[model samples]
Target: MKLFVNSLSFLLNVSVVALVVGGATGLAIIRDHQERLPSIEPLLDYRPSVRSLVEDSEGSPLLSLGKERRDLVSLDEIPEHLINAFIAAEDKNFWDHEGYDALAITRAAVRNFGAGGVKSGASTITQQLVKNVVLTTERSIERKIQEALLAFEIEKHLSKDEILERYLNEIYLGRGAYGVSRAAEIYFGKSLSDLTLSENAFLAGLPKAPTRYGLDIEQGKGRQSYVLSRMSLENMISEEEYAHALAAPLLISEGDNDTEQDQASHFVRSALTEVESIVEDAGDALAEGYVVRITQDSDLQGALEKSLREALIAYEYRQSAWKGPYKEDLPPVDSWTATPVLMDGDSYFVSINGEPLPLSKDSVKFANRGEFTLAPGMRVLVEKVGDKAKIRQVPDVQGAAVAMDPKTGRVLAMTGSFTQDGQFFNRAMDAHRQPGSLLKPFIYAQALEDGWSPTSPILDTGVAIQSNGQNEVWRPRDHNFSKSGFVTLRSGLEYSRNSVTLRLAEAIGEEKIGNLFEGMGIHKKAEPGLSIALGSQESTLLDLVSAYAALANDGVPKRPVMVESVSSKDGTVVYEPEDFIDEREPFFDEVTLAQIRSMMAGVTEYGTAWRAFEGAGYTVHGKTGTTNQARDTWFIGFTQNLVVGAFVGFDAPEPLGRGESGGSTAAPIVRAFFDQIDETYRISDYQLPDGAKIIEIDPDTGIPFDGGFKEIIRED
Candidate 1:
């Protein structure tokens, strides 16, 4: 019995020693791993005495999209009142506690656990800060453990001020912001340095429940008064101060606190998407705060948006007036409006005008359903009456506008329609509708390239020719349905003689014309025959704008660029538009371009687009095309700075009444854009490069003539 007792005691002693050894070994391993772990760097690095631009050169943030975020502020930069208010409302013994107060934590644990739900967190300011910075904003036991561990480490490493600063900057104050300074700016439109005690308390109260406090809505309800009372009750503020702060009215400044993307929301969204695609191609994440500086003037966007809304309203009113009666015998009257997209030939700063309704979200959803039913004429309903209001049974239709840079193919401004209520279907980039005589420029360009001088005799008299592979003889005619006598190539183009264009196409060969268009980035196959000469090739607004921009640039096509540059939060250039070089070769020779320009010059001076030049003070040179049966109408042209294209027609084929020519229907909208261009945008001059040689030539031919023809420049 004595031996057994001794053996048992020895076994117990050995077990205790073994357990201690195991624990010691595990602790040493954990400590080593902790020491080896890397420390997280601060969100933003401060460069020594270097100027950091919070906004772009245009005095707007590189990305002021969505709801404006508040500025980032430190605890020291914040007023004492704000800090006191926050401590009084959130955790009263915040300064005295070492990560947590035993008494307070115990009481909170009892109260929360008794309810069988997490009513209150037994968290100190340090713990909250740890959770915000290290752990995610999730309420769970595992996350709480992480937060506790991090808080204990932070308490050991950081001083009270440093911890407080981190907490102030890391806390989310709602309204798409994550900092106190940003909260103040979003709420009051001022910096933390400018905040008063009332303002400070208002912002300080927001960290608990920002949305519930109505801070996002900027509704200064009695929530401020409630916070002030809490501060007084906690002895953090004097009675007099609390009363004074409560009496103070909310003073929010209406300063230069506007969005860089306010008017250009549609354009900015597209540009951002494009930039994101480029970044993804490079295997980078877009969520890493990419600063995109777009080539958009906020002022121009505002003007365009304003003008579009107003025009839509006017059109709606006119439609409302026409509701009285329907007269069948009355002569048909075509009512149409043009939406022009103008972009810089060099830079892709796009400006757009005119307004067309867009497809509704409900309609899109209805179309997506596999099976559905609706009342007769139900589709025509749902016209916008005002912001967020709609009028039923109105003929609401979808249309789009687009503009791009001629040099780099960068899209500048694109408003799919007046009511931007759905995803953008940029008519300029999509929608391949046949452009009538507007495509004649390409044929004339081909004629010049194929050794046909501008003075070459082209018969304008009608002739039948086989079209496509159908062996169908198609005879194309002019607008007047008549033939002109023998005319120079330039004169034939100016007059838009269909027979002459057909003869020119025949001279160049159909396959050659198609190849030339393809070189200009037009992908559609040009059908063989006379109609191809009269703009029978179905092309999109983007295709036409790009082709015209080539002419405006003296034959150097620049791809449009909306986003100029994108940088990281550290100001390192992540993606730059200037870095990617375009490989598409120039489509037109300088001499041919010069001749084409002269012929198009006649469009504004003597042909279809004459009214576009006279009425609106626009330096516009373009051609108008009204397709047969009025299915599509187009006015593609360019100013000295930007190339613009406008198209107006029905989505489905229908006669758009009588006299729906591009000039009469679409030119006025183009004119309206130029008339207001200077009021809303900075005026830029157009210039030819150093080697462009200006020479006089007969309007009928590309050949140089002494004391005859118009001034034409041959870029060398």
Candidate 2:
């Protein structure tokens, strides 16, 4: 076959010229000047599109944002074996060829003639570089000739190393990476020095068809084998090295940045939104190659995400329904094997791959809970936890959460929605849902500032008020339907009694409460009605958290900000948010803030949310708000230094279950989230300011009474 190909090489060359000159002249039209070709100056002064790096508060990479993720490296920076591998795989005669290889072109032409079509490409590294940078990726004869001529021109201007460097730095290598250096991070999660022979070969084989071979394990290994054999045949590697590489296991990195960003999609997107506003021009932040410093604590963000997902899934499992299988299709139940890991009789752990994937505890306990036991092949959603993997599910019920530092108003972490792929609408900031009972604290705070004390008695029985229509009367009752007739103002908020709150609002009138709500930025306009007392107004989760931030920060509300600063790739300060954290003025006076916080503390103590945090070992002052029929449930709580708001509901209003309220649905989520947060912020008892009095009134008779001998004569 070689002798016959050599004999026909001349005929093929002649046929190539005849076909090119006669049949495909339109592809390569004659030009008087070389101006038709792009200049090599741009290649000499190369600046590939670099991805924006998003780092956490500690300067650790949380995610990357860009169109083409690249980490630029010079030819000298790349390892010698990697260069050898690419040369051996793509073009071993790269050093000898001027631009296009005549022998390779002749062979490719002969094969195309026999096959009756353009079957292959014989572009050397230089020609490919030209096609990638200067010319369109058209496969016609004109584009081909233009590409070859342009490659020859580039060869005259640039050295072999320069051409190879540009090719290596600019080629797309799958996973949104556009260079060998970035491909190393994406495929191996390490620098080139740490890449093994098998891993290096795998990357070397990806340029031909990155999407096809990079993702297909079988095809990737086959391609890697071919590249390895070429390297061996080209004397790039010894026989022993080739055999070892062939036998060595292909250790693919589990922690790709895209997937890592996906794990924190809500946070990454939220951070990028602020980053865009800060940078100049700010149209395309990814292309600007900015280094963004975000306020997200990865540890806190991870905890909130897991707890939120678990709480949502647990809510799903409690209902007497199944929200279909993962990916909307069940696994065949015959392919993969998963085993439960019993760790020291406490934490529950699970695994996917024994060698690569790390095991995560408490992520696979769904099977251990109900009758749906973990069979060997049962399909379940699994989340990649850094180096480990865990079983999980995407609950149909969507929700959002925000964790803020009440002291600095720095947004520690926030999630827009349950991160199912293809879901981009952020619920954390944009979701305009009714605050429900979460507004009780602010309501009582306004009332406290308006001459009503926490001990002020309010009739809890049903009261009728005028509605919008003529002679239309609106009667509001307690949420539990069972009224206490008369209860302390504190008890009204503690029990989340709708009637008591309405009575208090009626006494204080809508003007004062409306002004207070408006000041909290709950809404632009406040309505004149008693329903607003029961939180019948829409507000964002972030606004609600900020309102609670006042209670935690001595009545001062700190503005929630995501980005700390942004810098250019050259380390220049592009932009930094001046209002990153300001707003030192207090919304409520100290007395009102202290009194209202004490009343809210009663909520988790023995009121509606008691069962959720009875033994949580954390003192959380919060209110539970459940919308009509449990469509939306909210629990916005705060500690001495931290404030967190949790929301759980379907995208469109759907009933959570038969008996799930904010206390049952949302407060437990808050507890789960707080449970995972580090114990840096400690919960403390609310201190009543001067001139504040707590008078316990009898629920039956609305009369202040003290214990006969224990509490009658209390001393300060």
Best-fitting candidate, measured by TM-score?
2
- After the best TM-score superposition of candidate 1, give how far the Cα of residue 212 lies from its true spot, in angstroms: 34
| Residue lDDT tens for model 1, 1-716 | 24422332233223221222343443443344334432323312211111112233254764443333435565678888888877876778888866655566456545645665444566778877664444333343334434444555566678788777776766655334446776777668777788888987877776555433422224334657777888899887888988888888886443333433223345654565455445421101122233567776555454444444443333333332222112233212112212221223322111112333443334333323334332222222233333222222223433445555555566555655555433334455557778788878887887776677666776657678876667667765564533335778767777677777787777788778777676665555555555655766788776777777787765655555676666654667655655445466557776776667766867777777786566444346678888887667677666556565667666775555565567765554555555665532223244434544566766554467888775545443
Which tens-of-lDDT digit does each residue in 649-675 have in candidate 2?
Answer: 888878888989889988887888888
> How many backbone overlaps does candidate 2 show?
3
Using lDDT as the measure, the top candidate is 2
What is the clash tally of candidate 1?
Answer: 18
Q: CA lDDT of each candidate? A: 0.56, 0.71
Whole-model lDDT, candidate 1? 0.56
Model 2: colliding residue pairs:
27-142, 358-387, 358-388
Evaluate residue 192 in candidate 1 and report its C-alpha lDDT on the 0 to 100 scale: 76
